[model samples]
Target: MRFRPSPATVAVASLLCLLVGLVYLAMQIRTVFSDQLKQEYAGLVLETVERAESARDQVRVWQQLPVDHPADASGYRTARAELARRLASLDALMNASPSAVPQVMSSALSADANLTDTDNLLSNASSYWRAQRDANSADVRVRTIHIARTLIALAALLFCMLVTAVGMYAKRNRLLAGQSFEFERASLHDPMTGLPNRRKLLAALEEAAATPAHQASIQKIAVLYIDLDGFKQVNDSLGHRAGDEFLIAVSVRFRESVRKADVVARIGGDEFAVLIRTFSTEEELADIARRLIACVANTDAQMGIGHVRASIGIASFPDLVDDYRRLVAAADDAMYHVKRSGKNGYAFVTAAGRSAVS
Candidate 1:
């Protein structure tokens, strides 16, 4: 028989591959952003250099005119001031940048003693500014090249992750379709209650969120955040083994309480989430909420678990919020609101406001 990796192994391997891909993508994004900033800075530096060159040309024109002429003297003074301003701006930019070219240019500028000596001063300053511009251009080009290469690598990594994830998903489906249904169930479902785990829940949520057409047809979607009341105390007092049994029992009740189309996921140790795809009347939703609470509250005494109930918060999409993340957050907030007031109840949050589900 051909050796096949277990579903658990495949899931873990896929997760690791995706994690690595995401990390590389994040690093590349940072590099690209950094390069863009450097390019903008280089452009500013070049602009300053152009201004300096223009000032030098003006100074040359002023120098050709007679110094005795009133207009000529005024023009020379204006050109000198403009040149000084441009030089100052260039120096500031160079100081801010990590380029050695700025220091070399500054030294060249300092060597020219006579500010009014147009020919020599203009020649030296032009050479230095040109050199600085060339250096900045070179640096920008190198950074652009690096960004391009990083982007290519990021694209490749993303492709690899996509392929790996798809393969894992197909393998999981195959396992589910085969005689190893129990093993596949163990891989995707929580071992305690056999309910779908957090990973499966998130995957389902993401899929629902990504399909706009499906969402539009559904009319509205709701995520109910559920927390077991007094679960921690039970785990503390009854011992962890008993707590586990209680959880498994509670999970069964939770599953039975919901509609066949609805999905109940155990997202955390004592937390659950219900993804309600079909939107009915508020009265119907409240009925389901009551059923879940009653189921948990009426646990059999033989289980040795004290009175444990559920605090449920319902947040609907396009009704409570459009964004999936905020919708979940709203549900969570409402759940906590119930918990704070007193546990063993449910609350509903809509775009209008939050209200207790009596």
Candidate 2:
């Protein structure tokens, strides 16, 4: 006779699995939010650095003006004051940042000292400012990598949890008959947007990449990284309540814009990702990109947000890259390229080449 576990044993095991999964899910969500805060803080630091650079540039330009010129002297004084104010702000921001990088802190202090030293203002301030800016930029890059790794790990762990939960459910099906699995499904979706979350999107990518059927049938997998331009300005001007409304409206538009088979997800604040499993040619992808962009632009206008647009970067799988992380990174890099050149556009990244479409 085959030995079998008792129903009570299965019940206990199922409960234990559910509890573990919930705890892990909560921890992962907390980590994701924490990483987001870090990213935002880093963004604030970068913005401060840019403002400092601008003030420094203004001082330099004013210094070149004739020393005896009364208007030039007035402008120089104003620029110097502005630079000092900006430096104070930067210092305060650094102090407030929870994870302020040591190198960045040192650079900021050095830059402040150099800026304040009248004797070295012209001689060394520029160099100090540049050093601070570069250090902060490097810090941002490091933080980004850390966040990406955290997210990937979280996704993997969630996948494991899902598998365990499914197995347990299957084993206890008779005992727990008619029990709702809604909680499990809800954990994988975004609460606000009613769409798949980052964890779900990554899991889908992994599944598509691993499945032999997908490999045989799908011609290409395209990942489009979409970011809303001027979203911050809108949020600032219209308040966060309006901003939330805007996001909801845009999320709806995103869902409507994509095919039923494609996956659309809000990966971060004002950042979305679309995964297309089937596409015949580059033109097909381009058409989808254009439609998505138009959808966002039209929605922004309709919602009374002034002319917000999307900057998208497309990365194709197998043809351009094989790995999931690299594929996403390539798309992110291409999106930044569009942002740097001009907002409100799309670009494609592949092993062969890159092209931008406006």
Best-fitting candidate, measured by lDDT? 2
Model 1 CA deviation exceeding 4 Å by range:
1-187, 209-218, 300-304, 352-357
Report the C-alpha displacement of residue 71, candidate 1, in angstroms.
Answer: 99
Candidate 2 Cα outliers beyond 4 Å, as residue runs: 1-180, 211-219, 352-357
Candidate 2 local lDDT, 1-358, one digit each (tens): 9978775575576567656656665665566566556656666676776787788888879878898878887888888788777766766776676663433334333423455453343234345545655665566566556656666665666676668667777868844553445665677777878778888888888776665753555356889999999999887898988888888888898888878989998887899989997788888988988998988888888987776899999998877776655777788888998999887999988576565545
* TM-score for candidate 2: 0.48
Give lDDT for model 2.
Answer: 0.74
Overall local distance difference test of candidate 1: 0.73
User: 63, model 1: CA deviation in Å?
Assistant: 99
